[model samples]
Target: MSKHIVPLEYETGLAELRGDCARMAPHWVVPAKAAASPVAASLIHGVTVPPASARLIDAMSDYGD
Candidate 1:
């Protein structure tokens, strides 16, 4: 006989989460602000924030007391 594995709600949730993670593999494309000076680019578009980092930042903000 053959056995199979099934996903419970938690597993399904994790799978969906993984899918979301995969979809957002690319970091946010923050373009350099045209109106601002060259220095602004260093502050704004310097760091590329991947989706995972965005989620973590949101979670941290929520949990911060």
Candidate 2:
């Protein structure tokens, strides 16, 4: 059986998603510093924007040899 390979973009996007989730997870109340930054606000939007075909690749790639 051939090994399945996830694309680099999906992996990178997933990493970003994980990081964003971790960053947000610790805060029930957003910190004043974090909440006030435009950069931080922009990153929040990225949490919802996984790479295209990310879910499909994730599901299918589990069968790798």
Candidate 3:
């Protein structure tokens, strides 16, 4: 016969408290000047891949397929 192990029970409301704290924590906001700049904006929003890099990525994606 196999014995089943029971998981431990955490204190009630702990998860809710943690989530509340996380929601209340301060977050960084990008400056308007930086956001207005093209390069800075691209970096802040996401990485901008060059055409060559994109082609390389595409090639890699097809690898081992």
lDDT of each: 0.73, 0.67, 0.72
Q: Which stretches of candidate 3 lie over 4 Å from their true place?
A: 1-46, 62-65
lDDT of 2 by residue, 13-53 (tens): 77898899899887867657645535555556535537766
Question: Candidate 3's residue-wise lDDT over 1-65, tens digit each?
Answer: 99999999877598898887788776646557745534554457555779997777778857524
Q: Which stretches of candidate 2 lie over 4 Å from their true place?
A: 1-12, 29-65
- Segments of candidate 1 deviating more than 4 angstroms: 1-43, 62-65
Q: After superposition, how far is residue 6 of candidate 1 from its true place, in Å?
A: 50
Between prediction 1 and prediction 2, the one with superior TM-score is: 1
State every prediction's TM-score relative to the real structure.
0.25, 0.24, 0.24
What is candidate 2's local distance difference test score?
Answer: 0.67
Deviation in angstroms for 43 in model 1?
A: 5.5
Clashes of each: 0, 0, 0
Model 1 RMSD, rounded to 1 decimal: 15.9
